[model samples]
Target chain A: MHKHLLLGVEAIGQGAIDGGMSGVYAYPGTPSTEITEYIQENELAIERQLHSKWSANEKTAYETALGMSYAGKRTMACMKHVGLNVAADAFINSAITGVNGGFVLTVADDPSMHSSQNEQDSRYYGQFAMIPVLEPSNQQEAYDMAREGFALSEETGVPVMLRITTRLAHSRAGVEYKPVLDENQLSMPQDPRQFVLLPAIARRRYKSLLDKQASFVKLSEASKYNQYTDAADKSMGIVCCGISYNYLMENYPDEACPYPVLKISQYPLPEKQLKKMEAECDSILVLEEGYPLVEEQLKGYFAGGTPIKGRLDGTLPRDGELNPDLVAKALGKETYVGIQVPSVVANRPPALCQGCGHQDAYEAMNEVLADYGKGRVFSDIGCYTLGALPPYETINSCVDMGASITMAKGAADAGLIPAVAVIGDSTFAHSGITGLLDAVNEKSNITVVISDNESVSMTGGQDSSAYGKIESICEGLGVDPAHIHVIVPLKKNHAELVKLFREELEYEGVSVIIPRRECIQRASRRKRNISRHANH
Target chain B: MKSNIILAGVGGQGILSIAAALGTAALENNLYLKQAETHGMSQRGGAVVSHMRISDKPIASDLIQMGTADLILSVEPMESLRYLPFLSAKGYLVTNTTPFVNIPNYPEYEKVMEEIHKLPRFIAIDADRIAKEAGNARASNMVMLGAASPFIDIDFAKLEDGIREVFARKGEQIVEINLKAIRAGRQFSEENK
Candidate 1:
């Protein structure tokens, strides 16, 4: 029973669980953050210790999932599309070494530069690595296809890629329910060569992978996810993949869309279906979310002058995710352009949530280090970096996740005074630990303000590894125990918090100030839950 | 019946909630629903919109093209006019009378109100006043949702159910206030009728 518009990232996680996954490994990034968060919140998953944790980064998560597969378990490794750029070295070789068990890599792509640096599609990565890719249309298909992806990985002895766009990642519609099919759980790999990528052996495996391509194409043909529906009018046809199928179907009523429609959710470009749609229709509209993967393949098939329209000729938007209206326009619907409403909608960019602990922590830091130059604060991603916004404008640099601590270390080494890095509890575990260790080892005079909110509240409240252990982790990384200060984050505690922040700002060696508090939203939820439980 | 709706407003206006309400209605009616939202920073006073498609059969994408929206639900008059290009030729426009001028160029708030009053197909409701009358000023979004409900195939009971489900966790007082807001909205539209 499916209800609600379950976000795409959440769907991916549910898909994995419904597909009978043994483990999931991930490092959070916007647009792809919800997958791991969903697993953390799922009671059944947490009770099972379903092997969900925010690894140090994409690389660590990729390796962890690899380890799970090495132990003959079905594991899913997920990350934002750019995160694959970080884990590429390992990901590329994993294809050659192959897997001891099923491994699925699910990457969420952000088109239109929504919550991402670049809208680079992960399907290209799959193509480069010569792996089969699956892109599901909706939540149900996402769940069903996730199961198939793992099985396909096992069948081909290769890692599979499941690429989803922003719309597919976040939208929700009813999906026909399916039963979970369990996987074969074997023991750890007995042979060392299963992981060791000796050049000689890898070359042979690469050749064998090429030999398996024909079967992969055949598998695509037989995939239950891909379907061809005959339109009442077989004069024209539309080829839609992933979320684009939703747009195409939503706009064209059954009477309006008499052309045959091919819905593709699995990859390797089913040649037979493409040929059939081409032969049946007078012209074709290629509908896909991110790139021209299908359009390019279909172009090759159309050596004759049957015009194929899509992103290549700018029939659809050359960039950004496609929507139903765009597909309607392509299908010759008089595209509705709503009148421009008056400019009452002001440009209010996101700041940290009101009364956020990070704001209190940053405000105190700013007051404590008034003598330090404005550019001294380096912040990582998360709500803490919202300090770069007005009123609190405490942090100066926020390049990426975990960049704050390391960037502060670099700036301090370059002779900046009071180079303080503000990072969240979740971000510290995600990527700041190594940077902290590096600062200690180098004896850099960088102060790290670990804004411990007890949860990854920015990405919808996943538990952070540093929640209860920030102080211990700082000490374990060789920071002086005396320099590790824990302050309660609140306006009433502003003076004491500022005192600790000042002490850290002035310290000559590596110092850490952990401002700890539960997120207001979480605190409120807990209160309500506790009250409700008491009533029961 | 098949319908596509475009719900537009500023961030924090509960455009998302309205979309969710319609989807809940679709579910209650056993209709296929597909909806997409623009989330994150764009929600901070920036323009926000949700595309919703409801049909008897399976629905595809969340994106709708220009001139194809079956209904345009505008929480603010300006946001309604801004998204008018998406309204189908025969589609109706329901907008709030209040003008929230936070834009840099539109310093004179009355200018926007004047422009919105001129649109022929526009049906304006003072949702802000209705929300206030309902006992909470913040329920303006709910008032707008109520105004749009009557124009579409969505069930009022489902919208009420969604409002209750969303606010129930906040406590009984909040749930009660929101219920009143929805009632006020429904009553406001019905009285005008």
Candidate 2:
């Protein structure tokens, strides 16, 4: 077998292509964006003409995957954990509606808030939707899970969720290729009313979903990824969930753990193994990467009789990620502490690129907003979110992807006249458009600044769905054509941008100010490519 | 045999290129490897570290445990100290003497150098100047990789092959230049040690 060193996300992309995925839908988000990106550039996927276009948003991406599944083809939708909130409606209902072909939803959770606002776990979504969830312990498992998850989804007539955290998603390991599977022939759902969720039909479908829970548990019990190793020491049974298993093993470098161990990569708590451990061991320790999902479940169902230990019992930190040293301490092993960093080392936080358009725009916005009180600008997620930091601390609030527009409108409605909303172009296309629509519908006295870099700059400059369509999108949404102003965001355009922002802030109705420039990083990359081409 | 390294630098410093070359070398040696990398906002200009592990046997954690890494290979001076906590007591530190002064609070050069001098085992080289001397300042990452290669357990020939494999797509000229850069680096470290 040939081995290729692949990142967790790249392995999933390869797996989906090899497993006969018809399409991969996604909006670029960290630790998850590379899946679709990989597929888009894969030779086999390109030859097969898989549907690998960037979706407008996660909601649209989820719906598109569902539609492809409805047409009897394997499909995968990918997004970051918070992006799931946008697709939660479609995700939850899909479980009830079931599937015709096969579907897998890959949600990458950023534990410790690496590049994200929150460290929310996506496995909870799997349980909430009453579907099978697979968490890979390593990169190879990430590949295998995505490859096999479709068949598992079809078996239960439900969508499968492949959950990964930042560590697993961004980590790289050698993965062996599996035999390629053929795509399902084009067909429709066997039952005409399968996806039609009327009240009466929905009740029966909901019952069907509830009925599948037992099988999911059974599948988890038999899952090859979830293994139980017995040891003579019954003093403590360790339950290492997902990548936590790696941390656990790292603690015992020389040999296996003395205590019996349960490594769970498949969900539903692996009932049979848990029961086996509960009966055999005196106590159980739950080691998981994200929130204490497994520990909390064991505590609740086992009724505290087992003396379970984890984040709740102070065995692990309640928040952030788990490392080998922390896992060693949990296993009652002496942790290795290294040399302390020298006092001369200073803290280096992530900042906007030196010559970024966001910097120029922020400088101008700060200049204009200085006249008004602080906290007037509400920003959305993107590279511009960095404006909340450093020399130009321009943005005030950053709640979600598209909260800036709505929050600004809400504040304007509360008589905080001339509130400003700063949003990135890709984000504006994702969910900011609707908020802009809401503002325009009511003619809210808010100024919406669409920071257009013509790419999703924060997530490494992926093609923005809102590219070349922003001004038209604003006009189409019924914003007055005269109020929509587009300006180049550059040092030379500083005075013009300041003047525009001031004028828009004073407007009585919704106004959009688009500061347009290609991302500096991307521009440089493009320049390098062009020069290389010319030289060649 | 195992080689664990904490590769550190400021974002956009081409550390990933060093990682790419190292991963290629590891694979060439048929060793099991796991490398955890930083992505997203950090690449815009933040402190970043990649935990690169290669072993003859199967590896467990993607992250190297604290005080277990055999080497802390950094492309920036201050970044070398950032992961000192992950370096084993007997491990060596190979770093570029050049400073990447993106942050406002960056420490004085003498202070940073004083900390480096305190390390019992280290090789400090001006990889940018070396790479420029070898004709391609962009190949500075390659030079640093060469400077650290003697510490890594992998074969030097395999590392050369790794660089060739990585830069082959760019053409023979690029490959030749990088090879020259790496050899210059290795020679410097050998003499300095």
Candidate 3:
């Protein structure tokens, strides 16, 4: 088996490949963007004929995966934890309609507002949909769970939710590989009543969903991923799920802890494993990230439920996330006094990279918008958004993907002069297109600068969805051809770019400025790829 | 046994590279390792941090609580100070003294250095200068790794091997430079000791 320093979202892609999946669909976002990007990068995945591409939005991505599933092909849909809120319609109904082919929804949750507006847990969504949710503790389990998750979905005829967190999605871990599984040549569901959500058929499918719960629970109990280690100390039994198990062991590393430890990596609350832990220990600690759902489930298992501890009992924090120090506190262990080395240095804030196209774009935009003062520039997520800092101070708002256009439209409608929206090419495709369409349809006066960097340089260098079609997208969206200006943002063209930028700002209708340049980092990656190909 | 480390630096400065090498070394030493990172917001040149916990058993969360990190491996002095709250009292801090002005802050270099000198348990080196002298300025992370080697349980040679494994896949030139850089760091730490 080979190993990889796979990121969390990349693990989902790896999982999909291992599970014999045919297609992977997603729109780029933090924590979830890497899934499709990885598949595109991996040679093995391409040779396997994996269908991995960025969709227009979460809804489009979800529907694409569903369509693939309907064709009797295994599929995986991925998005950020918050993006699920946008795709919830299809997500909820997919469970109600049941599944003909194996399918998995991989959502990467971000707690602490890390590149997100909020830290909402996606696990609750799975519970609401009444689908089995499986979370892996490490990259190995992440891969294994993905492989098994498909089978579980097939066995139950229900779509599965594999929820990952920022840590898992962004972190790299050593993942062992196995021989790729062969694809199943299965037939699509021909029974029209199975998918038709007419009330009569919907009621039958809902009953079938409930009827399958017992077997699903049984399968979860027998899942190889849910394990129990009889480090049984009747004094205290700890049941940890996903990455929490890693923390529990990290908190008490020196000793085996005179207690039983139940490691739950699968969902539906492995009752068999919980019962075994409860039988051995006096108090059980539910060490799962996000919610106390497992704790609540454990409470129902006991006659009065053997006193359970977790977020509810304040053993773990009610909100945010859990780490080693918190786990140590939960176990009542002496402080895990980490290394006591001292720093011989100071603190520094972040800045733009030298020779970055974003730097030039920000500078040109700032030069043109200097008269507008600060807080007038609306921006989306990308390297260019760093313009919000001093020196340039070009962008003011950065809410999420593709918010610049909508935000600029709103501000311009409110009479904010020279309303400017700056977004990257990848982000424009991710969610900015609709905002642009809204601006065009409403004839909102806004100037949008689409920084076409040829690649998504933020989460490593991945191909941008609008790699070669920025101009066409703008033209197709009814942007005035004369108002739409294209310029290669360089120091030499600074004056021209700034001039065009000003003209677009002065335009009454929606104007698009396409700042085209290859991201320097992506240029290096392409060089590496060419050299590799030459050597081969 | 449970030791949490917070390693911070600018993006593209090999922040993840250091964490990966450290994690591999710990894993090789039979320690259970969970190295978590944030790939969010740190678009290219933005600040980046990786949380690594090494223990003899499994771990739950990969996050390092505020003011609880045992070791802070900072490639840049300012980035190190940014993560000071994550460090435990008397926690070891190893960072390069070379000033890397990320934000357009006008604080004088000497003033920043003076402020860092006020902190507890600090070891400052001109890691960037040293790495540059060693012929690869990008090897500043290895210089910090040199300062951090003695405190952790993993062997220096193990870290050297991990570094080799990482860069080998990139190219022979990178492999050679990284190995030499790691050795230079190890030797520099030894000289100070």
> Using lDDT as the measure, which candidate wins?
2
Ranking by lDDT: 2, 3, 1
Q: What is the TM-score of each candidate against the true structure?
A: 0.84, 0.99, 0.85
**Once model 2 is optimally superposed onto the true structure by TM-score, how far is the C-alpha of residue A456 displaced, in angstroms?**
0.6
What are the interface RMSDs of all the models? Answer: 3.2, 0.8, 4.8
Candidate 3 docking classification = acceptable
CA-RMSD of model 1: 4.3
* Local accuracy of candidate 2 as per-residue lDDT tens digits, B18-112: 99999999998889999999998888889999999999999999999999989999999999999898999899999999999988889999999
Interface RMSD of 1: 3.2
The clash count of every prediction, one per candidate, is 33, 0, 33
- Name the docking class for model 2: high
lDDT of 2 at A534: 88
Ranking 1 against 2 by TM-score, winner? 2
Candidate 2: which pairs clash? none
Q: Per-residue alpha-carbon lDDT of model 2 for A70-100, expressed as tens digits?
A: 9999999999999999999999999999998
In what order do the candidates fall by TM-score, top score first?
A: 2, 3, 1
Instruction: State the DockQ of every prediction.
Output: 0.44, 0.87, 0.34
